[model samples]
Each structure stands twice: as structure tokens, then as C-alpha cells.
Target chain A: MTAGYVDEMHEAFQTDLVYRSEDVPLECSPKPKDLEQTLHGLMKLNGLVIRSLEEIAGRGANAVTYRAGKKFGHEVAQYFQKRDDVEGALHELSDLLRGQYSFEVWKPEDKDSYIIEENGETFIYLVFHDCIVRQTLRRNGLDQGGPLCQTLFGYVVGAIEEITGRKAKLEIVHTGPNACLKKLVLK
Target chain B: MEIHVDKDACVGCGLCVKDCPMHVYELQNNVSVAVRPNNCMGCLSCHEICPAQALEHRGIYAAKRHYIDIHVCEMLKKVI
Candidate 1:
């Protein structure tokens, strides 16, 4: 990564830590999928929603689309949180979603490493390879950085909040065509 | 992971080299080659950027295949 880009990302993360501090309520019902057919149907619906939003709003509507996507993710996380602790919920959710999307989700091995505390802030890392969002964007002739793809980012932030019961902010550190590394910091 | 560069179709545009975050592809003899197979994250960014449809990868984590339009993928398979 270029130095300027790294600096920009650092600044964004710092700003998120300072500005986003309101926690969202966790009162949602969790829905777990028991069948592959159900998973496929859900993914299809999600793809449709994102595509329709992109078509209607064009590139300029990424923020709105991403916010919508994150809301969906938060709901999904709530469902998992009902059955497990924060770490367990995150792991189980990642496993279930990766199966639906056919992607690899790599998390830190050491449990303590999963939560980072520095300068009075806490964060978690979620790294994905072969993301379906990236694939879908490419199919639609869109770049990885496009607004349609922000849905996944929103999803991550929402889900993390549901699991941790704390407001969090997502910072995308690296986004390539097939991979993305993000940090979700508690606000 | 193994990346196959179709010599016949490659126009050597160097897009793969420019787009890959891991520096996995490099220009060799005017063609793009996957010099760092282990570093390949299977993101398939290079595959998407290839104008000539010259790239194929195997043994990488294949994300949900449904993202590609079924008809378009089938036609590309036949052509490539």
C-alpha cells in the first residue's frame, strides 16, 4: 500500500473512534438457517436488493446502500448473539455466511488477540478472501470500491454491534478485487 | 494455488500486475505470470481485469460461483 493511502486509512480509523459512540439496542430476533436451500434463497434476495439499489441510485448512492446493508448484517448478528457469546457468535456467523458465499474467513487464532485495546479503544479484525460481494460487483461491471459493495461493510459493522452490544465503526483497510481486510472498532 | 495464463489469448495488458495487492503477477517475456502462487489470496481480481479472458485459477478458495451470470460463465467456458 502507498504511504498516502495508509495515512488516509489511519486518519479514518481515528476519526471513527472519536465521532461514532452511540450504541444500538439489541432487541432483534435471530434467525438461523438449517438448510442450504434457505441460505441460497437469502443470498439471491440480497443480491437482488443490492443490484436494484445500484441501478436506481447510481454510484453516488453508495452510502445509503451501505447503510441498508449494514442494517441487515446487524440483524443477522443479533440472531447469532442469542445463542452464543460475542466471540462464539462472531465465529459461528462467519462460518455460516462463508458457506453461503463460498469464501474463506480468517480470524485471529489467539482469542485474546481477537480484541485489541490501544489508547482506550478496542477493535476486531475480519479478513475475507474470495468475497461474493467483490465477485458480484465485477459481474455488474463495477469496481470493488463501488457503493454497491458497501453493503458488506455495513453488514459487518451492524453484526459486530449486535454481538458485542456496543456501537462500533468499521474501517476498511485493504480492498482488492478478491480480498478485503477490515477493522471494527468499538466506539 | 495455480494460475494458468492462456498464452494464445493474453494481450499482455499488465492490468493483473497493477491490480493485484499481493504482487502475485509479474510481466515475463511480455506476458503476465503468477510468480507468487502462495501469496495469491484467490480474490480473482486479476481474472476480472484481464481484457483477453486469458486467466484461470485452480485450488484457490472459490467464492460462491453464482455471482457470475450463469449464461455468461457458460459461454466464456466454451470460448476459453
Candidate 2:
């Protein structure tokens, strides 16, 4: 009975659109088959984000700090320093999540999406986005020329799964004036 | 066998520590200190991942050179 509900929910939710940007497609579909491969992809995407910022810093640009609001009150600051491997970043993120962001929730919305407080102020939304990654880069400064189309959200979802060790209740929403994929919360 | 860290250019991201097949690094405060310098097989992985270009490995064959920027080196050492 539970399995039927899950499958039904998955089918219903996966077809919705999250956000639309330029030419990027919506991540409103089923996830990859293997979890490990998806996790590796997420790590690589994380690496890409870091590498992009590093490239900016390499050109003599000072590190820029971004605040993801209080939900992510912590600051992501870059610097010129020794390189550590992928494990280093993963470990750091693990520590940070364990120590700081274990509890955060989204602002309440009356829509179908349910908002639940996990621990503290941390909010999780399993939102689907058509192209927030490319949009974010464009906003940061990259032209990406054409509508940047890539599917990177699955990897992020996989990463979150690995971190939390819980199955995500996925959802897809349509395009919006802004690029936001899904809203996830601890289930 | 000399180990040098370009303190100023060091972004201190700690990728080297993770990549170190020899576990030669640890974070002291926010900086990476080579706890086991000898374990560095002189691999350049650390140098490549270093966003700030702060680390370099000089094996027996390689000569001393500026892996990271000198300006950064000057700034970080004092802060450390």
C-alpha cells in the first residue's frame, strides 16, 4: 500500500515544472537509477561551483562572500590558499551541516508544498528548477551566450540524500519570474 | 626535501589534505599546515586545486619557485 502511494506520488510530482531560465530544462522527472553515481555527480557539481569562484579569484579578484539568508546564515568566503582534495570539502560540509544547519525550514506557504521545521530555522524544499544553475552564473557574471541548458539538480538532490540518508519527497513546479527549483523539508 | 606553503595565496580550502594520499595536512585554525611533509609524493594535485595558488610540491627534481603569489604570501604569514 505504501509503495503504491510512493510510486503514484513520484509519477504525479515528477511531471511538474520547477523554474524556467533561458534554455535550461526543468528537473521535473525521475532521478537517476544509481544513487552513488548521482552522489559523485553532485560532488563534481560542488567542485565546479568552487572552481568557478576559484577562477575568479585567480584573476586577482578578491574573494566574494555570499549569504544564502539566515536559512544559510553561514558565509561562503573564498581565499587564495593551499588546495585540498574533494574529501576535504565534503568533510567540511558535513561538519558545517552537523554543527550549524541541521535545523532550518522554509517560510510558510499555503500551496500544496508542506513546510515543516526540521531542527531550527533550516528549511528544505524539494523544488524543481528548469535552469537556476545557469541563471545563477549569469547573475554572477557569466554570459553563457545561449540559453544555458544543463541538468545538475539531480546531482544536488543525490548529494542531499547522501547527507541526510532519507528519501526525498520530490515535486515539480512551473516557471516563475525568478529561478527556484523545489522546496524540500525533512520528512 | 623542503616544503613551502605560499601563505598569502593560500585560500586554505583544504583540498590538498583530502587529496593527500599520505595524509600530510591538517587545518590549524583556518590554514593548512603540512603535518607530514614527507608523505607528499611531490604530487601537484594540491597545486592544481589550490584556488589561491598557495601550495606547491618540490620533489628532488623540482627547483624552488613561486607556486602561489608572493603578495598573498606576505599578507597571510602575518595574519597567521
Candidate 3:
């Protein structure tokens, strides 16, 4: 009945009733064209989930979304080998996230390296240009830096931690219509 | 990036000055002005938060709107 219900009910529910499937099933192989999904529809659906999470859990929705995203990131990172440096880890991270969270390393005009050390602590700035979370928020007329945004923060931290074998924290520096900036602090 | 503050449309609300993380805007003569355009990361927070829609940035990276539907894009192409 819900977004992931098909996977839960795969044994019982057939192809027609299924809206989406995470894994490929031999019974019904619905092509992209047959899914009947548009960008607006998917974004609005995401908006619905976000709104629902907010209404039910209030500010706590951020924690839920963050945990979910972290789990997703950890899962994705399991496929890749451990990275030695932040740059390599981030490259693999970008490739893994791809269209979902398209981003680039950002630095000051004078700065050359993506990694920056502040008072002996090290971190990197990430400029997320194409984010589905932003699109979903805009579609729902919601503000930025909310629970939906935390999901991304958690995702980046989780992926970085899994890849580099080091704890990481993500902090939002700025949010905008076109892009968002976040600081990834490696612990 | 070049930030232009339309003097005519500016309401002197100080929203842009308050919202900019880079502190690129400052209120001079009760109107928002780009005091430090170089510091601006081109995030466009001021553009969305401005009640008057008075700020514009030139020669900046415009992120892709992959969320837009192809059908709507085609329709908009006809209208514009």
C-alpha cells in the first residue's frame, strides 16, 4: 500500500499491484517507461513522506531521517574498498550517490586543497548542487535545513566513516535554492 | 560573481544582509548593497529569502533542475 510495501508484500502481491520494486523480480519486469513515474510525482511523493514524518515526530523526524540515510549510506559504502584519503573517499562517495546528491568540493579562492585544517582540526567543504531533497522541499513549499536535509548530512557522514574507517560529522554551513554548503568534519 | 541590488525594488528590509552567511551584503543608506561580492558562495539564499525579489547574481553556476518533469519543460519551452 505504501512506497516500500511492494517489497514487503512481494510474495503475495503481483506485478500490477506493485508500484515500485527495489530488487529485480522475474515475475514482472517493469521497464522505466512502464513505471508511469514522473519527476514531479516522485518529488511530491518524497514531500509527502517528509511531511508525514514531520507531523508524526515533530523535530525528531530529523533523527529518523538521518538514521535511515546513514543506514543507506553504510549499505552503499560496503560495495567499495576502503579509501586512504578524504579525496578518494569523497570521489567514491560521489560516484555512489551520483544523481541523488550531486556535489563538488568547495574551497576559498586562495585555497588549493579541498581539505582544510582549522585550529588543528580537519574538515572539507562540500557544495551540493543537484539534490533531490532540495527539489522535494521546494515542491512541498518547505524550508531548507530541516529533517530532510539532515538525511543528507547523515548520509555523507555515514559514507565517509564507512569508507575512511574514521568517524565523521556533517554540518550545514548554508542552504539556498540552487545549492547548499556543508562542512564534513573528520574525527 | 557580480551581485546587483536593484535600488528601485529594494525595501531596505535587511533580510539579505541578515541571511547571507558570507556577509556579502550590508545595509548602506538603509538599502542592501553587495559589500563583499567575492565572499559570496553563490548559494542564492538571499535570492529566495528576499521578499521583494530584489537581488540578482550574474556569472554564477546554475545547478541542474533534474527534478523538473520533461513534459513541463517542453510545455514551458513553447510558452517562453
Error of 2 at A158 (Å): 40
lDDT of 2 by residue, A1-187 (tens): 6999989988986855566567665663345333434444544564466456557665322213221121121223121121243233334433443421221222223333334454563334432222334334433444321122122323333344444444333232222212233444334
Q: Which ranges in model 2 have alpha carbons more than 4 Å from their true place?
A: A1-187, B62-80
Best by lDDT: 3
| Candidate 2 per-residue lDDT over residues B1-41, each given as its tens digit | 35678777677788877865456788777788887775443
DockQ by candidate, in order = 0.25, 0.02, 0.48
Better of 2 and 3 by DockQ: 3
Error of 1 at A121 (Å): 10
Model 3 per-residue lDDT tens digits across residues A1-187 = 7867777788575556645668666764467555545667877888889889899999899999999889888988988989878899999999998878788888876567778988888989888988889988887788889988988888888898899999999999989989898899988
Q: What is the lDDT of residue A55 in candidate 2?
A: 71
Q: Cα lDDT of all candidates, in order? A: 0.68, 0.43, 0.86
Fnat per predicted structure, each in turn: 0.41, 0.00, 0.57
Question: Candidate 1 docking: what grade?
Answer: acceptable
True A-B contacts kept by model 2: 0.00
Report the lDDT tens digits of candidate 1 across residue range A107-177. Answer: 33233566777689877765676566765665555556667567777877677667766676767755756
DockQ of 3: 0.48
- In candidate 1, which residue pairs get closer than 3 Å at backbone N, Cα or C atoms, i.e. clash? A30-A79, A70-A154, A70-A155, A74-A158, A178-B43
Best by DockQ: 3
